[model samples]
Target: MQKITPSLWFNNNAEEAISFYTTIFKNSTVTGQAYYGENSPMPAGTLLTATFQLDGQEFIAINAGPQFPFTEAVSFTVYCENQQEVDHYWDKLLEGGGKESQCGWLKDKFGLSWQIVPTIMPKLLTDKDKQKAGRAMQAMMKMVKLDIATLEKAFNGN
Candidate 1:
């Protein structure tokens, strides 16, 4: 078992959420599931918890009812090796009612926030030339989905 798994509370959609997440990420899997017992609030055999892995990180999702909601304060960051990877994640994640947010942040259909960032972003943002870094920052702010080429162009002052 992992040391500490991030648990998501859902209103009876833990199974569905796990399935959706597994499809979006590579090397992902639904590890296990638990059902509510007879004495539980939900009916017996109802899905109560689902343990899953995205890429390699373990997560747990529970069908604990809608007392809580996902907020932008917590989000997962996907670091892409290139523009194509970034686009792939950005497009797939934003499908089915997902909303795009500023600076590469997006909320998926399940309301989980994600940051589709490129691996080059840190390098550009931390460049010794403040002007270049500022330009890159400006370029990123205008985009919903991050574009590596555009960021690079801005970084080079093109």
Candidate 2:
């Protein structure tokens, strides 16, 4: 069991969100779920809570109410090894009505913010050579979905 798990609150759409997420991630799975019972706030059989894993990270979701909506203040970061992996996740997560944001940030259909960042981003952004790192940062700032090749070229002063 993980020491801490992120719990997402949705407006009676936890099940749908779970399904969408599980389908997008190759290594994801629905671990368990609980439904509302008679006398509960919601209709009987309605999904109340669910637990799932995405690439080994466990998360819990609750079909609560619309009182609290997801915000960019809390976003999940997906570290991709290469451009292909970054593209795969960026495309899949933007399915339905997801909105694209600047600099590798986006909001999924459910309003959940996610950062599809390349694994090499940190290394380039923190390179010992300030000029090279600045160039890479500038290149990344202009991108919606990160491109590993562009970043590499910027870092190499190409």
Candidate 3:
């Protein structure tokens, strides 16, 4: 078990969100779950909490009613090795009611924020040559789904 697991609160679709995330990320599965009992505030059998793993990262989802909703203040970053990986995650994560945001950020159907970042992004954005780094940053800002080719071209002054 992870020392610190992130818990996401949902209105009442913790199960559905976990299922959707498992399908998008490989090697993911639901680990455990708990339902509200008859004496609880919610109806009996209502999902109270669910534990799941995504690519080895453990997360807890709770059906805590509608008191709280997901916000862009916090987001999960998906480090992709290349353009193919980036595209795959971007497409899969944006399915259903997901919406694209600037600079490789997006909100999934559950309103969870995700950053599909390319692995090369840091190297390109932090190059010693400020001009190259600036160009890469510019290219990235103009993109919704980050393109490694474009970033590389900008970095190379092409």
Candidate 4:
């Protein structure tokens, strides 16, 4: 057991959300599920919690009802290798019911927000030349799901 596993609360789709997350990340899958028992908050057949692993990180989802919702204030950042990888995740995550926000941020179908960032973004934005870095940051601020190639082009003053 990990010392701490991030637990998420869902209205009623803990299982489905875990399945969807496992599919999106490599070496990931649902490990176990616990159904709501007698006297539990949810119905007997509904899920109380489900354990899942994504890229070696453990996560748990609980069908805790609609008291809380995911917000832009907190989101997971996926460091993508290239623009193709960024596009792939962006498209897949946005399908069905996701929405886009400015500056590489988006809310998936589950209302979970994520930041699909490029691996090389930090280096570009922290370049020795402050002006170049500033330009890159400015360009990134205008769009959602940052594109590596475009950011690079902006950094290069092109």
Candidate 5:
């Protein structure tokens, strides 16, 4: 188990989301699943919770009904090594349905927000030249999903 596991609540798509998540990340799998007990209050076959891991971080997705929905306040940021990795995740996660938000943020079909960021973003953005960082930030603002090459170019004042 991870030191801290982030739990996501879904109206009823917990299992489906787990399947999708497990397919995306490496070294990850569904660890546990709990369905409503026979003598429990809920009906049979109703899922209570599903535990899974993504990049070693354990998470539980619960079928907690419509009480809570995903908001952009919390987002998953995937630090990518290169453009290919970024594109791979963006294309796969955004498959079927997803809305692109400014500066590398996107809402998956499940309304989950994700940020596809390059590995060098922090170093580049925090460089000595504020103007270069500003330019990169501006360039990023125009992109739906962040492009690492473009960001690198902007950071280099090119």
Candidate 6:
């Protein structure tokens, strides 16, 4: 068992969120779920919580009230191996009412913030050649969904 798992609080939509997430991530599964009972805040049989794994990372989601809403302060970063991976996640995560944000950040329909980052980002941003790194950084700042090709070109001073 994992030592710790990230827990998510949803506005009576934990099941929907779990379904959405499981479908989006290729390697994902719904491990367990619990439902509310009599005298509970929610109707009996309503989903109370769900435990799931995405790409081997365990997470538990609760069907809490609207008292808590997702904020950009906490975001999930999806490090992609290439531009294709980045584009795939970027498009899928923005499927419904997702909103785009600056510098590879976006908020999905569930209001959860996500960063679709390219794997090469760290190396480019920390290159020994400061000028190249700066150019790459500037190029990334101008993008909503990161483009690895553009970053690589900028890093190479092309």
Of the candidates shown, which would achieve the greatest TM-score relative to the real structure?
6
In model 2, the runs with Cα more than 4 Å from the true position are none
TM-score winner between 5 and 6, please give it: 6
Candidate 4 deviant stretches above 4 angstroms: none
- Candidate 5 global TM-score: 0.94
lDDT of 3 by residue, 1-158 (tens): 78999999998988899999999999999999999998898889999999999999999999988898999998999999988999999999999989999899999999999999999999999999999999999999999899999899988999
Output the worst ten-in-a-row residue range by lDDT, candidate 2.
Answer: 22-31
TM-score of every model? 0.96, 0.98, 0.98, 0.94, 0.94, 0.98
Instruction: Summarize candidate 2's per-residue lDDT along 43-156 as a digit string, tens digits.
Output: 999999999998889999999989999998999999999889999999999999999998999999999999999999999999999999999999999998999999999999
Model 1 residue 136 CA deviation (Å) reads 0.3
* Cα deviation of 151, candidate 6, in Å: 0.5
lDDT values, one for every candidate: 0.92, 0.94, 0.94, 0.86, 0.86, 0.94
C-alpha-based local distance difference test score of model 1: 0.92
Task: Report how far off residue 38 is in candidate 4 (Å).
Answer: 1.8
Residue 43 in candidate 5, Cα distance off native in Å: 2.3
What global local distance difference test value does model 3 have?
0.94
Point out the higher-scoring one by TM-score: 1 or 5.
1
Residue-by-residue lDDT tens digits, candidate 4, 20-87: 88888889978888887788777788888888898889988988889998777768888899888899
Between candidates 1 and 5, name the one with more favorable lDDT.
Answer: 1
Q: Candidate 4 clashing pairs?
A: 103-143, 104-144, 104-145
lDDT of 1 by residue, 54-116 (tens): 999999898998889899889999999999899899998988889999899999888999999
Clash count for candidate 1 is 0
How many residue pairs clash in each candidate at the backbone level? 0, 0, 0, 3, 0, 0
- Looking at model 2, residue 25 earns an lDDT score of 86
lDDT of 6 by residue, 1-158 (tens): 79989999999989988998988888899999999999999999999998999989999999988999999999999999988899899999999899999899999999999999998999999999999999999999999889999999999999
**Better model by TM-score: candidate 1 vs candidate 3:** 3
